[model samples]
Target: MYKKILVAFDGSPYSQKALTAGIELARCCGSELHVLTVVSLPEYAGTVGEVEEMVGKAQDFYRKKLEKASQQAKTRGVELKIHLLFGHIGETIIRFAQEQECDLIIAGTRGWSPLQRLLMGSVSTYIVRHAPCAVLIEKGKEEDGNG
Candidate 1:
């Protein structure tokens, strides 16, 4: 049984599936549920003000997503705590999981092809390699004709 569970979300359909899975698992285990969305800071900014503006906009965007996620969990009778942070996505998620002492971390995959993942570098792969605890990656459904 998990005492604390964290779901790494990004407002995507894949992440929504992860949220649903987290909610159901939390309900079953009577665990504290947490949803985290990380906003990747720009690699280069013209000024500090520009960075601040980007962060602000990201916060606003993720806030609405988190709210919807909260509502979804509420309907499932699970209370989900939401968090938003700015950093490299994979590192931020792992750090937050460690800080929260989460027993389990759930994340969603984009179902990218091996070539795509190799070229793009996968966030889920990094988390799986570096996370402090157990990880469950929810695989996204492939679109028809892709195969």
Candidate 2:
């Protein structure tokens, strides 16, 4: 059973699905939930201030998304905390997970076809490959009530 769950989140629907899954997992295990959003600065091609500004904007967006998720956790009475980080997404996630002593890291898979992934790579892939702890790569979408 997981004692501390670290979740990597963004504003994407995929990330939201992972967040919901993380919430349920934490609830079931009575684990402390640590939600993290990483703002990856574009490498070069911009002024320092511009890069900083973009990172700040991304952090703001992450904060808002984390707040939304917090409301859900609060309603369910689940223990949850939020963090916004500025760095390479994969590296930051692994580093934070280790620093926090998180037992598991949950993250969503981004869209990347097999060929494209071989060329450009993917974040979830990197995390799965490099993270020292357990990682769950969630990609499924929410079920429609139509069923």
Q: What lDDT does the true structure give each of the candidates?
A: 0.90, 0.83
Per-residue CA lDDT of model 1 for 63-121, tens digit only, reads: 99899999989998999999999999999999999988998999888989999999999
Q: TM-score for all predictions?
A: 0.93, 0.88
Error of 1 at 101 (Å): 0.6
**Best-matching candidate per TM-score:** 1
Task: Show model 1 residue runs off by greater than 4 Å.
Answer: 142-147
lDDT value, residue 26 of candidate 1: 98
Model 2 alpha-carbon miss at residue 54, Å: 1.1
Superposed on all Cα atoms, the candidates' RMSDs to the truth, in angstroms, are 2.9, 2.8
Task: State which candidate has the highest lDDT.
Answer: 1
